[model samples]
Target: MNQHDFLIALLVFLVAAVVAVPLARRLGLGAVLGYLIAGAAIGPFALRLVTNVESILHFSEFGVVMMMFVIGLELEPRKLKNLKKSIFGYGSTQLAACALVLGVLAALLGAPWQVALVAGLGLALSSTAIAFATLAERNLMSTPAGAASFGILLFQDIAAIPMIALLPLLAADAVGAVPHGPPAWQTAGKAVAVMALLVVVGRYLVRPVLRFIARTDMREMFTAFALLLVVGIALMMDAVGVSMALGTFVAGVLLADSEYRHALEADIEPFKGLLLGLFFMAVGMSIDFGVLAQAPGQVLGLVAGFVVVKTLILALLARRFGIARGQWLLFGLLISQGGEFAFVVFGVAAHAGLLPPHMEALLVLVVALSMVATPLLLLVFDRLIAPRLHALSRRKDDAIPPQHNPVLIAGFGRFGQIVGRLLYSQGITATILDHDPDQIEFLKGFGFKVFYGDATRVDLLEAAGAGTAKILVVAIEGMEDSLALIDRVRARFPHLKIYARARHVSHVYQLKDRGVEIFEREMFEGSLMMGRRVLEGLGIDPADARSVALRFRRHNIQAIDRFYPHYRDQTKLVSLARQARDELEEMFRQDREQRQKQEDAEWS
Candidate 1:
């Protein structure tokens, strides 16, 4: 409570985090486990140095908020659209199925229905932060299995909204207790109003506010304004008793159109990392080691049950849903754990008379142990399941049209296919530069020109297209290499107005620094183009359609001017971008509506 204790707690947390995280990661585990181990080590069970206190949880709560904010930043409309089937279908089904199966088992074991439901939901989901970070670190996110795992995680995150609402109702004392804090109806009403406000502001207001902020050209003010938006919205959402996580998600989704979305993500990232670490540590602290020591068998059994139950369910579900066997196996194994929200739900249940404290403590241990062991189970999937699937997947490729373009495309195994095929139709000559020399030469005898070269190298760039008198479309693979190519090409070939691909907003900044004009990222093509087409498809004339798109384009282009510079800073970017998106979207909406109204009146 005092400054001395606060500083000590801070030091202990920072020191524990710094030490434990890298150690776990080096051992092929994730930071979540490190934080848990760190917390446990420093608790009375080990070091007995930092006394657990109420302030610790409050301090760690900020981490959860920051993490959620970043998560919100990443939940851009375009990315979410790409993940629609996985998030809504696989993710939804996995959570529900896991919860139902676990709930039934718990109920059969003499647990009350309410406690069983709450406990089951706790064990049904995996940690998104851990799974994603670990997979990305291993460069496996692009794999089908990896993507499937991600979809389920993203869906679980979105599902947090309904879970929050459901928690109170699941509490047996829900009808009696809620009258103390604003009436339940009032809380529900405020939540609805806040969400409605987010939609309206996101739809009609965000863009113009950003445009106005742009006109001012005050960079510091803009960043401040962005953070203000995140905190303000987060605060308002918290005030209405909605989880700040869900609020930030909604805000992030709404601001997907804003130029500052990526900037906001980068800015908010570090704080999210720290605070989220704290949140995980707090979750770890909640685990009753005493209960575990007393009933190690029961604790370990609960964890094993989740491993077996969730894996079987997810495996069968993935198979029935037509996921590749390897992918199905991966999906099953990866999701065989509980999530952080288990602690939140359990605490609420205990408070609401839904769960006995002794039982609640046991559930906490189960969730903690499951989370701690998650990364290891992933190793099982990778070592045992994935390779088998890869081997089996060979036969299925028989039906796949063979790669026709001789240009050995490295990344295009997906994105590069279009460019390669269009060139094929044009009868243009090319050779592919890929890291896999074997794959390259294997296709070479098949009447395709394939070669092995690191595309980022100047020699490789030249070999691909630097001086052979043809265009170089620098879709040369990863963001780093792609941006490196942009820089290299700019200096080498002043004549080439480079069309560099931007993977994220950070990549956009790097390209922009090289004065790249035709920069394309996934979102630009995926949603922006789709929106323009939808308008035209609705019988809107080409002129109006182009004008509408042009207006958004110009606004976004200008907004990018601000977003690019503030890429690494989080606090200010969130507030400013949120405001800018609010302002700009409204101005554009009003202008478009006014024109439409005039056209309607004329027709009348």
Candidate 2:
């Protein structure tokens, strides 16, 4: 197609997406499927609105790269450190098992050993984008199943580096030619060096540059810098024969601890979303129905067999790992689809003459079909299967009535444990529900009764005696879970008084909005203690500092209520905050003056 034709095609794609995505979302099918269906409709087989699919596909692959970068941004270094074991253990096992199983099946179906291995490795990868999106949408990203799924995805991304390097070797053997590239050790050395350089640059050079740009207060320029960083790292990785996605992901990990992490995510999000939508559409466009029509049974059978096998494997793993039934089912269905990386792997193989055109097309078709089917599968699980399972679980739970404990603590973290310990010292028995199995085990060793379940779930709350508990102490680490649990408690058992913890000003606002009159900011008291120490260091009397802290605390509490109403309106909130600050300073100054005058009078 000419330049004008390309422009026309772009307009058509944008228009179709704009119309189809919202309609699809309204109909309960996600935007991914919407883009896919739209692509298919406008593809050569149907409306023939845009015929040059290859060029678009090639350009849109960067969307997947951008996606990896964004995913890395969400994974902070601390969270990754906590998840190291799962990432290596479950992730490595999933890859090895899936490859072995699928490789053997491919060999049995007449593929050569090399080809079978490539196919197995390629198809073993699950779609990270779809799986994470599904989990995040349902607010399950903190659950065990979600963590496991994320770990496996991270491993797949890491595994892609070696797989890319291995592809040419597979191709070389297939075509009986010497591999015309750097030796493996040299490539490994280069990759390590490049990664180290990226880390250094990100930590030392990039941050300062970002800070300088931030100081200028130019939002657009800072956003440009973010893009430049991602694209520059991508180019460097590509230059060294590494995957661009891997490069950007590594860059993202390095930047995860930066103060600008959230800002970078916000800036890159729109580009990521649009490009990813285009990438999905390109996949849909590449699905040649003509090829499928030639071997309908073979195509359909392969897709079904792959999904069933992967789902069964993931289900068994999740079950053995003690994932909850509802979460495991959702996890299995969400991750059974082949990933976008498969497109890269298959394209590399096909270019190397390792796969025949027909086989490559068939595999691509299977991957796309699996991706398209994921949302539908999730909808089925959510609507049809989940309700019956919940009912059964609830009935079974009802058989064991928890011992009567007047106080129920939803979390057993540092915050909740302190409350539990204090109550224990007073001889008040408290029931604790914590989802962290490790924490529950530790607390059990300490002779505390802690149940392993999500506190936000109503059934678990019922099992914990929320119906009879006199007070609920919500010290859950996550603000969302705390708020959700509070909402449920207020609706179901209004009589139970709630003492909640707020992580920040925004969280405090949310709690106040929810009628939680007795919530404490998690850091407020500690900050007040620090303020007292600072006052003492400045040579103020200990008693005076203590009095000042008390007064400040009371006034801050009152200010919270006044400021919360305008929280959503930035202008009004800023104005109110300034007014509150000035008023507090004036009051404190007046009190100091009164104390000085009284001291002078007493001396006279």
Candidate 3:
């Protein structure tokens, strides 16, 4: 396509996504499906807005690589080691079972054994991006179901490495080598060598380089280096006949221990999010409406059969693994769809002469359709099935006692207690609410007025006399719960002064945006105290150290206020954070120099 056409296509995609994603999310379908629908809406078969999808697909594949890299960053060595049981136990068994069953089913449908094997393996993989994104969006990523899903997805990522190498072998000629390709053993050796090289270089070379860039305090430079690292590793792997996605993943794991992990993530996340969206759009664009129209029954049969088989297999595996019924069902539905890797595998197989053009197109359509159906499936299960399951299992609870106090304290945990105690010492009665049943009982034993209920609930808030309360202290550990409670207070008890405890700068920004003017991060004061102690340990006067810490704290709070408006733009936020850090350091240095001069003058 020409430059003009490319720009037009880009505009079309951005516009479609901008319009469709919010609407889809508002309607309860996730962003992945929204992007897909958007792509289909503007595709050649529909509006014919952008016909040349092939080029965009190739370009957008980097998003998948970036995603794998981000996933790797999350999987620090400690975390990966922790997942050993899930990865080997449930993960391995799940893949093997799904592949075996799907392969058998494909063979029964008249495909040759080898082709059936390929199909089975391709279909066995699930959409990691979509699954994790959905789980995280709904605050389930830390739950049993999310953990299980993540473990399975990590295994699938690892499995993709071998599968990529194996595909060329599956399509190898009768002479035991691919056409113009090296022998299977040689290919395998080269892939292993490439992986080793990536690890060694990443461990030794990359960290120092990243540290050097980070020390420069230029966020853009660091981001560029981060991108270069991921893309460069991917290209190297691709040159050596390994999957680029696998290469980026390996690089991510290697950099997991680097000090710049968070910085790299901050820099790379926006790109990853955008590119992933583009990738989904590309998937939607690649869907063949004509083929679907020609064999609607066949296509629908394939889609339905794929979902049923995968879901049943996953459910059985979850059962064997002793997963809870609710979680197992959610897991089954989330992963039943075909993944992005299927497109690459299908392409590889077709090029290797294993799959016919028609079969490749058919498989592609199946994968796309299945992906499109996943979010809808999740919505149905979450909205319809999950509620009934919970209703059946939920037990009746004792009524919460009415509490009428001038001050209402939510989340009487570590932070909340200090606030509560301060109020108690002054004889200011504050009704404390806590969700932890055991903790509530323990606190009540200590003669503290703590109640058992979620503070975010309007009824519970009302029970706590929120309408009469003058100040609301939200010190919840869970960020979402804390934000929910803040929202409720703002809407219902706007007269109450809300003093929130934020977990981090992001939380501070959220609270700031919501008109919670009086909030402090839980760790900021503690960290400043530690810094003050360190200064004292370094021979600085204790009083001076305390002053320095207080000044730094004030400056930081001011910086957060200044930067809060641009929090949504990660790059700008990172830059602002760096600038604030630099400014604080410079201020401290100036203070120390001035203090030294004054001491010298006094001695003279």
Candidate 4:
């Protein structure tokens, strides 16, 4: 395209993305689907705003490569090794099972065996971009379902290389001709040799070069090197006919132990996000709407049929693998769509004559439509299904034995434990209630008496002697929970004095609103102590440091009290805070001058 056309295309893409992504997210569909929808609307089949879909898609596939590299950076060699069971066990089983079932279904539908096999393999792969995006967006990447999904996707990326290699053999068989490529053994050897070369280069060469670049302290240069590394690896992998993503992923893992890993990730992230978004849009643009129009029922049926089959298979695998019951359907639906690799696979198959043109077009539409359907399906599941499952899965509150201790602690975590221990040391025992069963069991092993129950529940609070207890300690970790417990105790047991833990200044205001006079901002005293020590380290007299800390604490407490009435007004709150800071500084300056005068008098 010419410069003008390129600029126009960029403008259209940016405008579409800006308009579509937020709307999709506002509607709870997600940004991936938004990009896809934007692509489809401006694509040739729709608005005809852009016609060169293939070139854009080819360039944007590097986004997948970059994403894999970033993901690999998170998995150290040890962690990757730890995932062997999931990668090979669950991953291998899932791929084999899905391929077998889908391939059989294809053959049963009268597709030639070669075409059927290729189709099954292509469709068995799930969209890594979509799955990872959803998982990361939901912050589920650390969950069991996320780990399992990653393992499956990682395996699929690795497996796609061989699948691509298999195309020639399959094509040759289909056409009753001898295979034209180098011998299978030679190809395998070359792949192995290339991987070994990468390992050697990454371990010996890449780190030193990165170290040299980092010493220059040019952030842009570091970013440039990071991109150069990925691009170079991709080119090398493509030359060897290996999956560029897999190659870059290995490079990332090799650098996982490097100090530059975070820097590399930070540098590469923007490129990855943009490219991945572009990749999704390209998938959207590539959707063969003409093929859909030609055979709508067949196309829609294939999309629905394959998705249901894949989801059921994945759900069963999740159960077998002992993924959380609540996440079983989630794990399935998150990855059931035909992946981006399918586009490449089917395209290759068509070129090699393994798949006929009409069938290839149909398969492409099926994959794209399935990609479009995933976010919608997940939105429905999240809105309708997940809440009910969560409700059913919630553990019942543990029974609390009757207690009459003078002190009732709502949470026995770090903050409450210190209070409880201090009270116990003084021969005063408090009744402690915590909701975390694991913590309670562990603490019980240390001979501490603790009950497992949500303290916000009035019944549990009463059972823990909140009504008769002289003091109720609201030390729950969650701000909302602490506030709720304070409200409940104040309402139910008005005679009880409450000592709450405030997480921050906002929390202090909230506690004050609830009439919690004995509350402590959790970090205030410790921070003051640290500040005093820091002053001493800076050559200030010890006595002066202590006085300064004490004075600062008193000033802060007075400031909090003054700020309370205006807490609901952000403008007033900020203004008062700034004014208080200046006043405190002035007070400190005067104290310093007074101390100097006192020293002068003593010396005289």
Candidate 5:
């Protein structure tokens, strides 16, 4: 396309996204659907605004690659190792079972075995972008269902590599011709070698390069380097027949422990979001509305058939894997849609004569419609089904026996455990209530008497002796949960003194607003201590370092209180922050001068 045409297309896309996304989000649908609707409206079949759909679709797929890398950055090698069982077990089983059932059904319906196999494999895959985005929207990524969904998606991405390779052999079999390509063993060897090289380079070489770039203190340059890393890894993987998403994900995992991980994520996030939205738009444009118009029943039926089949299979897997009963439907619906990879598979199959042109178009439509359907389905479930399920679970919740412990501790994780242990050592046994079943089980094995119940629930709090307890410690990890517990206790038990843990400065502000004066920022003390140790290591006297740390802590607390009223005003907040920094520095300077004068007087 010419420059002018390209500019026009870009303008159209930006306008459509800006207009439609908020409307969709406001209507309880998601950004993904909004993008899809925008794409369909401007597509050749509708408005004929931009007709070059195929090229745009292929280009926008890099968004998925960037997303995978960001996800990998969150998952260190240790965490990935922990997911091995789920990855191979649930992932492999889900893929195989879905493929077998779908393929067999297709063959029985009179499709060629090759076509059936291709369809089965392609349809079995689910959209990683859609599932992750939806999971993140609902803040469900840390839930069991979310982790399991991630494992299945990761395996599917890895499996796509071999599936692509197998396509040529399947095509050759159907057409009675020898496939012309490198032998399977040679390709496999090259893939393994490329992966090993990426690991080595990512582990040893990338950090030094990133550190060098960061040292230059150029934000744009650092961002450019981050993009270069992803694109370069993608090219290498594509050359060796590995999935680009998988390659970049490995690079991300390698850098997960790097100090620059957050910087890299921040740099790439905007590009990833924009490009992913464009990718969804491209999918919407590619949907064969012409075919849908002519054979609406066929298209709609296929979409329904595949979604239902996949949902049932995933639900069974969720049950067998011991996912919470309440999450079974959620787990199924989240990933039952056809993925972006299906477009590539079906297009390649059509090119290789394994599928006819009409068949390929039909299958692509099915996949796109299924993608569009997922967000709507999830919306319905969230609005209608989820509330009822939650209410039912609340009704069936087990009761905790009333206790007379002097203290009540909620959330017995690392933070709460320290408090509990210290109290226990001092001959004070507090009643502990933790919501995580796994944590409660593990703690029980250590001979600790703990109750498993949600602390946010008023009944649970009352039963745990919030009414009679002298002190209530709100140590829940989530800021919202901690604030909710504080609100509940302050409302019901006015006599109880509540101590809360704040996740960050903003959390402290919220807690303070709710009248919680006794709150500790979870990492503040430890970080201050570390800074003091660094100062001591830098040749400062240990006692002086201790005094400086205490002074800084006091200054910080005063600053927080002073800034509280202006926190809502960003301009005033920034000005006050600058003023506070200058005041602290002036105080430190005076302390140093005073200490120097004392030393000189002693020497005289």
Candidate 6:
């Protein structure tokens, strides 16, 4: 197609989407659903205003690829490692179970073993985008059910690779001819090798390359490299006749460890988003609205079938995993539909002779309808399902408010714990805010008093009695986040006194400027402790050693006051601060010696 045609197609999709998404959101539905509806409405079946949608779909296919790449950027190797149990344990089970159930159902419905198997797998996987976004929007991402849902989604991602690998194998073409699009073994082997290469490169090569690019300080270069990595990998896979989604996901996993992961992710994010919207629109355009009109019962029947079948499987699975009964139902209801892969598998299988054309068209409608239904469907869980679960949970286990304490602790990590324990012996009742459902979940065993929430958020802080608390002790770690929280608290609860921990002098200044009454540099105590012990061991009297320690603290405080302004700028870094401290230490030595000599002369 020419540039003009491309621009016109884009305008149609965008204009439709811009209008549709707001309407969906305003109706308490998701924008994804809106985009799908927009696509369908502007499509051949409706206005027939847009043509060449198949080409647009092909072009927009890269959106899925980009989404996978961005998904890869967000994941960390360490986090992946921690989720190994969930990935293998819960993930493996859910995939196998769902696939088996769906496969059996397909076979019963008269599909061949291979087609049925693929269909089952396609039906088993849930929408990660919908599940996560809805969870986050409703503020349930931090909840147990939310965490469990996340674990399952992580498994689905890993599962997609194998499914993609299996697609060609399931084809009926002869091994010798361009017959089934290459032999099954050849296809599988290439997929394995490509994956292996990504692991090796991502682990060994990506970091240094990123560092090299970073040194050049060219954003366009980095973006170019990022896009190039995705496109290159995708093309490589495509050349080998593998799925591009598989290639892009591999690219992500490989670049997962690059310290430049976030920057690369940020750079690629806009492209991914645009591409994904286009892809969804293409999916929308692919829908056979005419087929639905001809065989409304068949199309809707399959959708209902898929939802009922998948929902039952998911609920049973959730229950088996020991999620509370109510959440189990919610989980089941949330995931029971054909996923994004259904579009690919449906198109490919129909073309590959696995499914009859009529059946394929029916399934395509089912998949499209399912995608559109996702956002509204999740509202069932978020609104009706979740509240009922919470109500049940409340009835099963109730809570009582803790007595007030002067000091309120938000996190009981190493930082908050020390303050809480110290205050505990003094008969203090410290109210702590900790929103990690995992930690709060186990708090009962430890007999620790903590609540779940982001302290920077007003409701959470209010729950912790920020208004009534005499002192707010911020023992939270991390420089940037802590500063942000300090600023937030200072703005909302101005009268509260804050004592915050700083990992360095800069952190000290950051907290101090926020009006924190006490900001202890994290490393200062170690230095002070060392100096005190040395003085005591050097035969200094206990009382005089204490005096010396106080005198040293006074000098250190004075030095900080003098140098902090410049230190705030990178012009006075750690080395500069050390140099300034050395000069102050030398002056102290001279002052001590002069005072001793004057005392001796007076005695004489």
- Arrange candidates, best lDDT first: 4, 5, 2, 3, 6, 1
Compose the digit string of candidate 4's lDDT tens values, residues 236-274. 999888889999999999999999999999999999999
> What would the per-residue lDDT of candidate 5 be over residues 470-572, giving only the tens digit for each residue?
9999998888878878888888898999888889988888888988899888899999999999999999999999999999999999999999988889999
5 against 6, candidate with superior TM-score: 5
Position 586, candidate 6: lDDT: 88
Tens digits of lDDT, candidate 6, 73-129: 666767667666666788788888888988898899888786687678777777665
lDDT of 2: 0.85
Alpha-carbon lDDT, every model: 0.71, 0.85, 0.85, 0.91, 0.91, 0.74
List the lowest-lDDT window of 10 residues for candidate 6.
394-403
Better by lDDT, candidate 6 or 1? 6
Error of 6 at 296 (Å): 2.0
Best by TM-score: 4
- Candidate 1 deviation (Cα RMSD): 14.1
- TM-score, candidate 3, is 0.71
Clashing pairs for model 3 are none
lDDT of 4 at 288: 75
Q: Stretches of candidate 1 above 4 Å error?
A: 53-55, 78-82, 139-151, 154-187, 203-223, 320-322, 383-604
Candidate 2 lands at a TM-score of: 0.71
| Per-residue lDDT over 1-604 for candidate 3, one digit per residue giving the tens place of the 0 to 100 score | 7799778877898899999999988987888889999989888778888777777787888888898898888788788788777877778888899999999999999998878988999999888777877786788877777778888887887787678667766666433863565666887788889898888898899988987887899888988998898889989988877778778877887788877889888889999999989888888888899999999999999999999889988887787776777677888988899987788788888887788899999999999899888888888998899899977765443365776788888899899999998888898888888877768889888889777776788887887789887889999899998998888788888899999999998888888889988988788788889989999999999989988988987897789778988989999988998999999999989998999999999999
RMSD values, in order shown = 14.1, 7.2, 8.2, 3.0, 4.7, 10.7
Question: Model 3 off-target regions past 4 Å?
Answer: 168-180, 214-219, 320-322, 398-604
lDDT of 1 by residue, 219-270 (tens): 7667776767777877887787776666777787887667877766766776
TM-score of each: 0.63, 0.71, 0.71, 0.91, 0.80, 0.66
